[model samples]
Target: MAHRRPATGRVSTLSEAKASSRAARSRQLCRSRRKAVSCSGAAARQSCSRATWTWSDYALEEAGRLTHPLRYDAETDHFVPIAWDEAFERAGAALRSVADPNQVEFYTSGRASNEAAFLYQLFAREFGTNNFPDCSNMCHEATSVGLPKSIGVGKGTVTLEDFDETDAVFSFGHNPGTNHPRMLGTLREVSRRGKPIIAINPLRERGLERFQDPQAPVEMVTLGATPISSAYHLIKVGGDLALLKGMMKALFEADALDMAAGGAGLLDREFIHMHTSGIDALRADIDATDWDAICRVSGLSRDAIESIARGYWTAPRAIFCYGMGITQHRHGTETVQQMANLLLLRGNFGREGAGICPVRGHSNVQGDRTVGITEIPTEHFLERLDRAFGITSPRAHGHNAVEAIAAMRDGTAKAFIGLGGNLAVAISDPQTTFPAFRKLDLSVQIVTKLNRTCLLTARESLVLPCLGRTEIDVQASGRQAVTVEDSMSVVHASRGMLKPVSDTLRSEPAIVAGLARAAVPNSVVAWDELVADYDRIRDKIEEVFPDFYDFNERVRVKGGFRLRVGASQRQWDTPDGLAHFLVTELPLDVEREGHPYLLTTIRSHDQYNTTIYGLNDRYRGITGRRDVVFLNADDLRELGLEHGDRVDIVAGERELRGQTAVAHDIARGSIAAYYPEANGLIALDEHDHASGTPSYKSTPVRVRRAA
Candidate 1:
């Protein structure tokens, strides 16, 4: 077999390759560092030892330094470091001074542990507000909101073990190689079994096409990469919902044909009758949609759609996995529900090697939300929480990320306490988000690294450095293990081996506990004691959530345990006590008016979420630049533009506005741009009303030559 070589055309031993990669990475870092120092107009070769600096010294100096998380700073910004006791008093005073509990919002990041998140929510609820706007609101909120209506569970149903028995794996709108590298091992195993892996995305990612496992001896020695995508389809941006509907339509048609030929076992007639509803409505909708519309929107031919659907139907068991791509659209919630509907039609739920999987971006994002980081407060959960902590929990609904920013901008919200997150930089419409931060009476941030959010300083702002996941967290008791929940809803323990970067830093749990102790006078629960021993925190968790019964003991068992998902067991937790089907009216306009193209934001392979590891997007054949945009070859011809031509993209209606032009390999009638940079073009109000998630994937824009 003839093997393909990388563009560099140089092959070496695995060790040598790794060394070269590291060296190149190091050189880039050094150059960036030097440029940063030069830009700051400071002495490039200053010695920090002259200032008697400690690890925390650097953090203290850079606390409110950089204007934005993505920008560089020239001079160190000094902050008056206060004593721990003084900090506690200030925090408590700030909380007490708040005129209304509704005015204060508690923000959580994916970096928060289960214990800290639970405590943070408890403290906020007890403080008289349930305004827990977590990181999930910006990312996978659609999945959490959509899945329940479709199949009865918000979390993915398949366990890691199910991958072993999968006959076919369908992945969409996610890049696993960079976002979750651990999943590559599972993909490799599935490939070894000769199972077909289908990938549907606008970009042809290298990991989806081929991957070389550094841990494999045979593949490493042979200098080979495994082929991942048996069938790769480049669907147009925002076309996933249509593509999914088309596939289901094909499957239903195929099932009818099979039945006409006297095949009774082809479809799960029994399961459909017992476990689902609204099949007739779904069938009618699929029948009404024409083939031409599906093909044009999906950028796939009728034959291609049929072929993929045929393969899916032939498989005894399959798993459908998706990422932000499916959840960042105008119809993000509908997209997720369609995925659930696809699974349900085939009896995919409650079975081995079958289910819907929404790959979470952050390690502990799902866990934080599970432990009470939510805008919508549940009555039963709060009542149980009140019993456990001996405090009256607030029942008032609070703001999500979008509403929180709106509140702050309008002076409705006065104080903001971020448990862990880059709120100002992460939210849409920075023009409003940054100013809202400045308007806050008190802005408290507990973080591990420096980010732009810290620079949006309040009149009385404090930056408390905290421990990173890679660092050891030691409290008064001893070393500790923080717990997190995976995409599949399995709760597990994570213990850090690396030493703390700074002695002044505190654990997330400890920071939350410190604030709780200060804010709540004569608190019944021992905040400090819970921080010392995480098991006690889990005991409280078990009391509130019945699924976590025997939490401490169960977590000790190697894989941990899965939280109960009623949907997987054929139990619908909906208002009607049945899985309901929602009908979405498709837009008549196939393409954006006047503009010959559509635009979507994508992540580079070297990046994870908002963190850019390097400039190179190995999958897209790009190197050393993020400003470049992607365009389809046919679209380029249609627009009378060549490769690297500057094109402006205009987004927003009459009020909100933005425009950017860049050179980019995106599909015809579609354009691709990097996030955070493009995020400014989107408005805060432009989100799913039901889920409150930003429409990051499908932003209608007009493209033309830049003046």
Candidate 2:
């Protein structure tokens, strides 16, 4: 069981003694695992286990605090500390140098707050461009693009309360323990009730198998781990589309036999006729999908696929949950629609404990989009913004992450302003992106800690330090609390309790206000007044998005409030005012000749996105290194290789050499490696045409002996 220091405010002397004793035991355990007798004292380790290290551990122990603003010196090829005024001046000049606002791209990270994101888009539109390349383009763009076409909303409809009554949960392509630890408690309770949890993924994660809650003292101290999944299915890379179709086919076949016997069918006929359209086309497409092809592509027997279908049929209420694994594919958007189709088949919308749940990562990614941080903005949102701020906003569509990178590569984009994320490393094809970034005339990074992206210097780069979520944010108005929307669309306030790491650190809102004032001086929006109090910002947001009426008051309530979703009420906002079942064609390029192995990039357990906490992945049983690839032992035997053999991977024109291959329980013909490092294997152009999301989960690669 993993040990975490409980946030019990202050500790007593007894608490300190217990913590010291626990720390000593932890250090001894680590030493025993490594078979070393010598010790390095208590300064060598933190409170958590080797796998789970808190953010403070990373900031204090790994990467030191970034306390001042920095600028890149071209002559010296290094970063030097500079004044905030000078950094903003350089950033503003670069923004002004571009003759066309379309040539300047603004990127945002998911960690930013609602107030910051709203101001960012307002500034961009006022500056005469909409080139908003955000982190969502690389992660959940499929959900944003597909769900709107199918159910008239892009977010999940179920709330936390719905979990109590849920009969079954179908989890796909996400590891809750590492990615979203908070969800493990919910799943742990759900599992204790003996509800069925069907897990589908290429890798058999330890978290999904068992979890010991640190919050529960007995569970942690007694080593009582609760079982999470009732059954775990290993799907092949890029095989979700076939597997989903197979489940629906089995259900449809069962319904047909029931109807022939003069009995009521499994499907909701009245709901289908009244609330949905294009069923005939969808049915025909599903019927046309051959079982043999489904079995071959999905790497599952017919019986296994039907067994999953049986769970879906038996459950009166079910919630289908998925993550990036379902979205990071060439046909990711279509795959999302299929999941919606399955839910709609049973009239799951607007019902208790039932809906499509796309579990989002990051703290407020959903809220950021809700507040209008998108490349493609609707005309209604633009018109409202123009009316509210009395500014003529840009009506042209903007570049997504992929397009923004290409623009930088071709020298079309002159400047890049990042709000929070490590954009280059987070996106695919770093080999091309790294060079493209160097060609940029200006690059600005608003961050709290040093990262690989901060080090990637441009002609004129600025690394501006900002207050993190854990620090108090004080502006002209007074102390402030920013709001973040969860994966379930619950908007809540997050107040910082700890003091600032550095007195020089500024809030994201203050930083954006400074940039906006210098960049676009003529804009009529009261940038300073908006930043004075977050209530005024919420008011402006409410003015633009009427769905958030009484935003100031509603956000103050406990657990906050939920944004208006038409599909949650069974009110389809599609073109025909009805949910449509989309007919999709399976991707033809799923399998490649010679490139028999499909390599997927994954994050280590000790890392969050691109922020490496330590050189370890305890759940996967890896330590002290990330330059290794996980492969099935049978695949190694077939290739005439051993577990620790050195290999070079080739994907299309990109190559990653000398990666150590480790035998694991991953699917046959599939391989996994730590991300950002393996990002070079993914090509820039290889992405979903509809969503522009890179195929990060399934890149066809050839592994050979490293000569």
Candidate 3:
């Protein structure tokens, strides 16, 4: 039996030490067994062993080095370790020999720092191509494209402080416990304060249900988890747009009732009159939408929708937060706009606690876009950049991730340079994407770990290993702390604590500098000097973008500083002086589906993007393997399948001709499969027309028992 310990924050007691040991022993026991068992049953047996495992042991396990480091192989599939200098020279020559500037493409990942990202974009633009495909294209392109039309900016309006003061929190399509552990603390505090957290998702997530913060002393000691969501509404997948529209419709009806009762302060009439346009058109659309149609489409009854609207009306301030689940749909851009429309009805933007929050996946995805990693080139940014750097930045519009992949497969793109990210695993249509990668004249990757992308070798492939976020980066000028912008646009300094795993490992910035120096021999900037001290790079950034003025000094502050967003102050950056309202027509196929189901990809609790930490997904009651899919019990019964029975999902599209995935537990009609695994089933060109973001959420598919 495990002994109870004190909730004193520190793990010091002898019983606590003993409990951790037992937990490890149990895990070892489970691993030693060959047959598959229930994860809950495994947990029950391991509970005694878990108490014996220390936090350090868990950390070490997560930080284990790759047994086989990726290297360049000239002959077979096996990678042979080569010198860094040799790889760089070969990569530079291959890139330089490329015939056309448009033939080369550069990809950026969210893990890259602002300085490295800025330098990467500069290098690509100066190289005479605007083909800067980034990770943002896959995640929050909807928010980036939608929010500007609604609130004048692409970023979330609220800060960490706003979570404390808000009366209500509305979370849509995001699981804070696994994706962002820091957010769990905020939600727990809100739950403790008796504030309602309304969660709208198709599947009930464990993190949203109850979260046991490993950092919390009392919770950790008691093994108790705090309940997060006050109300959980399981809406049908791809029905978010209809659901949001229904909510707005309910709000309008409620506002009408308040007006009839002679209430003057029910709606923000002044804000609508002064700051917005197309109110009449929006009102007409809401009035035209029948409650029954809304209810049927959204998978919610009229009373239930009304109840949620009343909660919104009752709360003084509310924060609307969404994740990739909202942004990966076919109508993702319009869905985001609907969210904005709901917020605008209450005048949520430009306020302290009430605003839009698009929970970004990666650390610096937003920052990378801000620095100029864009397919759509802004003339103002380019003109300013050219003047600052004394080099002509590409002005022509270029390809996004999908477009780049298409170009590569079609033999239009000859060279591929990824600063960081697992392009092969992250992209859709691996069958075509892998073949395209192999066709590259030069394929250069700046990576930290061994991934599937590194295996797609080109005629001239090079892998430059870099320091991880947790690893110390020492240079000629001494130690350096990299700056990363969070989901809220808060740029903060992250100084590494651990030493580099390998002596040959280089900093991302240093590696970029070396490549830039080798590729462009007559370059004006002192690449080595800038790499020595990152402050110089920041200085260069300040020179290029005036918005980042005094970058070094400002980053020295504790939480760093917020980048100025002109839209927050009611400054419109659109073509017109005012925000434009564009009408979107929902596709008939999506609206009138007879199957009554929509599929969406999800990240497991033990995963981050494409990185598979482990097979067990503790939140969704899935364990041992990642092959199983989550499903509704009714849907399963209707299909004549059991929990453990395997089924093949064939996406109903010609482009996905040979794409079929086998999985189990997915909600009936509705299916939840892991991303990249399901990515191939989604067509390449099937994306949001406005933003060019692939429709990862709403893939129409037929499920059948596997042979």
Candidate 4:
């Protein structure tokens, strides 16, 4: 069992701890500690985080304080403790040795503060390279790229308050109870109010079906659970495009029928005419699409899909929420466009209670991008950055995650410096990614705890201990609060209550400054001055991005302010200055003939990203283990396998052997397994071209009983 810290308000007794394990199975079993690890993607986000118990799932408790800076020795296969200055000097030497600055890859994690991320990008550009491969590259990259072309903004348009007035909610491909447990409370309220909540997923997650408020003593006494998801539809893996198209087709058919009855059409013609363009192209594409193919590809009957369309048609205000299931595919960008089209038909944007919501993983994933963490830097942003720092930034495009891995594999990339995160396990196709890391000339990981990526030893690798978000950060100016941006646009300030976990542990900004000072000898910026007081960093940020005008004043005014999004006001900021109803072709062929099953990777209840707290998937009826594949009962019979039988999963030349098979209620021809462990079964190159996001949600594989 993983360690469980006592809740902030008061520690739960042993009876409650035992109850927690059982509660994991029941709908009312959800728990989120009310304390703030707040990193409001800080106006700089300063809002309190509504994340689960202890901020992370036993991550802080498991990795004890006092982790030392260590160097990986290949001869003894051990990590020996080294002084901080030595580690930084060696890292600087390896970076300087690289003939071409572009040979080094600089990566950032979502957990980093806005200040940390800004300095990270600044350091890389100062070192003369634009190579940045961050965590968003593997997830939500499609949302950041695809949403902008259609709506003029990449972030979600709706706020938390939107759920309050939404007449209906449509969710796809994610399990919130495990991913964002905080949102389940909002969902519970929406469901309690009698609004319709429709769910479309391959596997029927227990969290989306029902939830009981453990916080409400009334429910605890009565053992009453609130029912969620008014209607649940099982869509096959790689079926998002088809399902979205089918819904649009049904709406068009409904519009024609309504118009013929001598009444107002189903389409919001006025809103579409005034705020959008390219409706004709989208209409034509849907008209030419075959209903039979949509049904076959989506695995949903026409009537069933039409029923969902009716739910959308009847509701005056509706919000569409989705996760990697829609964006981790070859057609991810197109799928996002199609979703924008669906909401446009009803004028869902800029309105309360309605719009597109893409739940981003990690606290600051969106914030990192907002502060300029990208391989392709816009001319305007680059100019502003250069002007703010009085330095020249490269305008050439550089490698993303996929490109970085490929460059390393081909011996073109030589060094790696990670701001945070377990990138080695997070990225797919470990076969190629792991070896690429091993061959690097140097690697420097800035982290609080040990992870798989820390072990991917290069010629000279260093693991530098950093302060966790839960600990206080005192710079030369004394105790300072860091801001963070949430999935929503709101930024909040985070103040850690705990004392420094380790005397030697440094904050991310300090570590970044250390790296910058050691790596860029000719650097003009005063890194020490900036690190003395974070206010100086904020002032620099204000100069670079105009959104943060009154840098220090606005952030301290209560809750952090929200960044302005043009789409929120129905103001299209696209090249044409209008929202678009772009067309996406239906994806009919997804699997190879020999690949009978489609396997999708998922995180367990005990897991948060690549950090494993324990081995248990409580909601999926899994506990104490992760080596299990979930297959439909009928698929199990077809393959002559039983619930406890061992099997081998193959994708191309890669194989995951001796996996226990579990008979589940998942959609036929679809399989589910825990991520990172099953990452070997996915190909590194299998990703979306436009956004470069790996196809982890849907992969065709062959499953056979093991000897």
TM-score for each candidate, following the candidate numbering: 0.88, 0.91, 0.88, 0.91
User: For candidate 3, lDDT tens digit of each residue in 1-707?
Assistant: 22222322122345334645654564564353211111223322321212222222222233334221234445543344556677777777877888878899889999999889988877777778999888988889888888887767788888888888888999988878778777888889889999999988877777788888888899999999899999988777777787887888888888888889889745688877777788888888878777777776667778878888888878888889899778888788998888888877777766777877889989999988887788887788888888877898777899889899999999999999888898877876776788888888888888765456765777777667788889998989999988888887788899999987767688889888877877777877677888899898888888877888889999999989988875556565665645544444433466334445577888878788888666557666554445545667677677776555556666654222212122232333567777767787777787877777787787777666666
Cα lDDT tens digits for candidate 1, 1-707: 21222323121224345644654655554444333322223432231222312212122223222111121121434343455677777878988898898999799988888988998998888788988778899889999898877876688888888899889999988878877688888888898899999998887677777779999998999999898889998888888888888898899888888889888745677888877788899889989999898888877888988888887889999899899988887788988888887877888888888888898988889998888888886788888988988999877789999999999999999888998778776777777888898898888888754455765767666767677777888877788888999988899888889987556667788878888888888778778778888888999999998889999999989988899887667777887677666666554443667644556777777665655556566566655555556767677667776555545667744212222223333455677788766777678887877788887777777656655
- lDDT pick, better of 1 and 3: 1
Residue 633 CA error for candidate 4 (Å)?
A: 0.4
Q: Ten residues in a row with the worst lDDT in model 1? A: 65-74
Q: What tens digits encode model 4's per-residue C-alpha lDDT throughout 1-707?
A: 22322322122235445545544542122211101111111111111121111223233324333356777666655566777899889988888899999999998899999989999999999999999998999999999999999999999999989999999999988888788788889889999999999999999888899988899898889998888899999888888889899999999999999999997999999999999999998899999999999988888999999999999999999999988888888778888989999999989999999999998879999999999999989999999999999899998998899889999999999999999987877888899998999999999999876566776788998888888888999999998778788888887778777987567889999999998989988899999999999989988988999998897788887989998888989999899999998887787657787996778898888788887776557777665556678888789789876666778899888899977777776888899888878889888889898999998877899998776
Alpha-carbon shift of residue 376 in model 1 (angstroms): 0.9
Over 1-707, each residue of candidate 2 has an lDDT whose tens digit, in order, gives 21222222121224346545554554454444221111122321221222222222223224455667777656644456677788888888888888899999999999999989999999899999999999999999999999999999999889888888899999988889788788888888889999999999888898888999988899888999999999999888788888899999999999999999998999989999999998999899999999999988777889999999999988999999999889998889999999999989988888888888898888988888999998889998999999999998888899999999999999999899999998988899988898898898888889876566665677788888898987898877898989999998888898898998778888898899888888886768898898888889989989999988999899899989988788989999898899988989766578799798888788889898888776668888765566678888798788877766678898877889877767887888789988878989898998998999988988999888777
The superposed Cα distance between candidate 3 and the true structure at residue 374, in angstroms, equals 1.2
Model 2 off-target regions past 4 Å? 1-61
| Candidate 3 similarity to native, TM-score | 0.88
